[model samples]
Target: MLADLRLITVQEYHRMAEAGILDADERVELIDGYILKMAAKGTAHASAVTRTEQLLRQLLGNRALLRFQDPIRLNNYSEPEPDIAVVQIDPLDYADHHPTASEVYLVIEVADSSFQKGCGLKAKAYARSHIADYWVLDVAERKLHVFRSPSQDGYQTETVLREDATISPLQFPNAIAIIRDLLPKLRAE
Candidate 1:
């Protein structure tokens, strides 16, 4: 926590939206009680996200729910809208409430400019919330940053794989995803 800043809870975050302090279109989220503006999605990042989603959907089918750029409540102070959240299949499709950390199987972030935040602060929040599988697709660098073995401190294991590599989420071991497919014609910006 920073000494100079005041932190707001998730409840307050919602209230701000209702009070018009925050707009519905605002690209912001609550991370560790801090209201942080999310990075704008670039062409490469958007394409990567769509590709990853399609691949995961083909693999998962009716097994897991795939949420694209949707909110998942991590804690009292953290409710981030990850690029892709692979969660359990709820009968009501999570209409009752937002998916929580425990319901999440894998969290993926497609990043070009926000690569650091995806692998750093966001990764730490996911790890602390016991998200066993967290991946960051580095659109600019054309790499996959995989984080596993979560702890209160952070992820115990962190691996960066190249575009030629293959990866499988913790929940869906047999469903392999190729790194190259996740980033097609990616270029640094």
Candidate 2:
């Protein structure tokens, strides 16, 4: 016999958080109406995220709002907290709500243990939301996976850049980031 699983909406997810059902320290995101526990950040992953955050801030400056490890409301059933989100500058600083797909210029996820999910489910969700630019910093391989031209099925364009390569956001073409600069240097064994 098949079992039925109930899926919660984004609204319900928020309500659960507000109601103390989901603690503040709980690292979870609503994905496809399911609460997905985010992977614990390792030293390398944390370092990479910090480095990427710094680089993005330096390059974007006042041109965009850079949010780190914050929720971007994708749809009614999904609200994934990406590692770095390049958003439109809002005077109110998005006090009333999280950045939506339209407000977001780029979403970046720094992946160590979550590489598969980052490039698979996360990518699909972002693309389905019509997010134009999505990037996954693969910590294990030390590469940058860039996804663009979103369609309902998935991103139409996918590119992988090595450490020696550089990439710039489609919105801010002048501000470039070397792939290596945004990643954590592997320690010498």
Local distance difference test, each candidate? 0.92, 0.92
How far is 137's C-alpha from truth in model 1 (Å)? 0.3
Q: Model 2: per-residue lDDT, tens digit, 128-161?
A: 9999999999988989999999999999999999
**Backbone clashes, each candidate:** 0, 0
Over 4 Å off, model 2? 1-3, 187-189
What is the Å distance of residue 110 in model 1 from its true position? 0.6
Residue pairs whose backbone atoms clash in candidate 1: none
On a 0 to 100 scale, what is the lDDT of residue 14 in model 1? 95
Q: TM-scores for all candidates?
A: 0.95, 0.95
Cα lDDT tens digits, model 1, 1-189, are 468887899999999999999998999999999898999988888889888888998988989999999899999999999999999989899999899999999999998899889988999999999999999998888899999999999999999999999999988899998899888563552
